[model samples]
Target: MSAERYEYVPHHLLRRRVRDIASGVEGELMAVINENVSDSPLREHWVELAHIRGASGREFTTAAANVVPA
Candidate 1:
């Protein structure tokens, strides 16, 4: 068996990542919080932070791979 690779990145940081990736541009690249795949609290938090950092809109993904590389 192989050990799992887990990187400890806090939710707040992830929010920032989304904003940075979007670069304040409007389009599919904007950050988004999908209620279907994401819980209320998590989704709300990310959404709030994204807007706070001038990234109210950005692509959303259930996995980290969706987040743009910083």
Candidate 2:
């Protein structure tokens, strides 16, 4: 980081994002929610999913393991 490498937004000032629909922006936070497998009978499939999806997924199992489901 260097002051000499300046560009537009040249001098900083904080700005809040307008979230209302009337403000031409969606008001809700967007996210991709993962499915809850805590009560599933086919919980083994979910653990396999964690492996197939690699490092970004649920890599660690809990203390109760299969008893607590996926």
Write candidate 2's Cα lDDT for 1-70 as tens digits.
2222212221111121112222232211212122244444444222211111113342222211111111
Compared with the true structure, model 1 gives a TM-score of: 0.19
Model 1, 11: alpha-carbon shift in Å? 4.3
- Tens-digit lDDT string for candidate 1 (1-70): 1132222344434434332343433222233332232344333322222222333443433343334434
Using lDDT as the measure, the top candidate is 1
Candidate 2 TM-score to native: 0.16
| Clash list (residue pairs), candidate 1 | 30-57, 30-58, 30-59, 31-57, 31-58, 31-59
Give lDDT: candidate 1, residue 5: 22
Model 1 residue 70 CA deviation in Å: 6.9
For model 2, state the Cα shift of residue 32 in Å: 1.8
